[model samples]
Target: MSSPVKQTLKWAQKLLPACDGDLNHAKRQLVWLKEKIISDRPGGAIDDKLSEQEQTQLEKYINQRVFDHKPLQYILGTQPFCDLDIVTRPPILIPRWETEEWTYKVIQLMHQHLDKSRPLRILDICTGSGCIALALAKHLPKDSAQIIGLDISNKAISLANHNLNIHKLSIRNTVEFREKDVFNLDLKEPVDMIVSNPPYITHDEYNSLDPDVKEWEDPRALVADEQGTRIHKRIIQVAKHCRPYNNDLPRLIMEVGGTHQIKPLTEEMQINGLKDIEVWKDLADKDRVIVAH
Candidate 1:
């Protein structure tokens, strides 16, 4: 008889023709569902058996996946980011590996360079689920950083607060979530750093993305005008207007689209008087993040 893993994966893929239809993604979801719902162990010779009830539940989930084209993360209702179990919700962008990787890097840089003798204030704009802010609060030197997470959606704020409360016991600093529009945002106090994983996907690009993303994720959290540089410019303007923090702190650390975004964003930062622009590429060697102070 075929291994249970193989059998289930085959069944899952057959049901996904109406969905993303990517075998690899289906396999991943299959394994994750098995591990989570059935308590099956990963790796090695797979021998876990599913009970009738379990099989029924899995079928229901697979049906949802195929018929609704819903993302697995949405079905499971959580995403792991920066070692934190971030809550995922519909219409709100889920945390991606890219965001997690860069957030960890930013935390490390902040730990090494930020002047922790005094309080440090950081803003995470368009912060869906508050993953960045929560992760920073969890890993960064606690009790000294006041991280604020801002989003334009009320549901986003509610979900972000829910995620924060889930980990509030371990996080010792102040992390607040608010629903505010970035375009009309006005801040009085200067901040040490501003980090964002804004919507930079172009309309055309968004159209071509996987159904799991195009169908489920909020377009406002993924698409921007001006060829994906609209929100980036507004963020740059925010960084430009903020007075420089005292001595050796990054003013802006923002995730951007691949290589095409770097030059123009760097120029925008220069024109706005922000210096020390640095491009941080992802493991694929494509420019993924831009930093300036």
Candidate 2:
């Protein structure tokens, strides 16, 4: 009842259960194998340099790792975020749906704040993979927006640079990446808005996360101290430092974990003099983002 290719995939699937390994991992490996076979077909005028035996060995090699828990994103060396393909390596957090939503919302808010004739400045903190900054730079009205992305990790900044180059979104004059800790950033000019999806998962929550995530994603990017309010507190504190001298303070938009995280962070923002603080819900109607003036 099964074609030869289908049978080959079945054997690989049986050898590696979807629960035991990532379901997507098995599927990707099969795709790679099929491509190789297709490209090497006889009389297709392609080099059959890899003999049939060698091809079989390559599939087995990929299958063995799929049988393990290696993340498919890491295996593929890339992930999709907000219509962009981003490079992902170890030590950089993979951008998630919530992060993209937060970034998109910031863009929407910025459009409301700045009219077509005025240019707006935006800052993105803890910019792993440069997803937030790059997405904003790519989508915002090119003539009226500037974006800066900052990350503590040098590796992350490097990857961000690569991605910017890849997308040709490098308005080298307008978009920039910097190596700096969120807690210690000092901007020369006041920005119109600051956005971040900082590390907010508590230690207990980190430990309880799905093994697929806990085992593969960067641990440092996921865990935070003091019920996951530590980084959130620091970002709010820095915003207080950057508050404009006159009436306007840069608006803040941050992605928090959920409703459970709303109260403590709201209180912290108020204590730091961040007025008009409010929590925004994600698509699921859970409290997923916080906004303050």
Q: Best by TM-score, which number? A: 1
TM-score of candidate 2 against the unseen true structure: 0.81
Tens-digit lDDT track of model 1 for 1-293: 77776777676676667445677766777767766665433344355577677777788777877877888888888999988899999999989998888999988887778674677888999899999999999998867688999999999999999999899998878999989998989887767789999999887898799888888998899999888999999999888776566656678999998888888899999999999899998877879999998
Number of backbone-clashing residue pairs for each candidate, in the order shown: 0, 0
lDDT of each: 0.85, 0.74
Provide the TM-score for each candidate, comma-separated: 0.89, 0.81
- Flag regions of model 1 displaced more than 4 Å: 1-27, 39-49
Candidate 1: give the clashing pairs: none
lDDT of 2 by residue, 169-272 (tens): 54432678999997677667777677888889989888778665777777778888988878888888877655442333346888898778889988999998
Candidate 2 deviates by what RMSD? 4.5
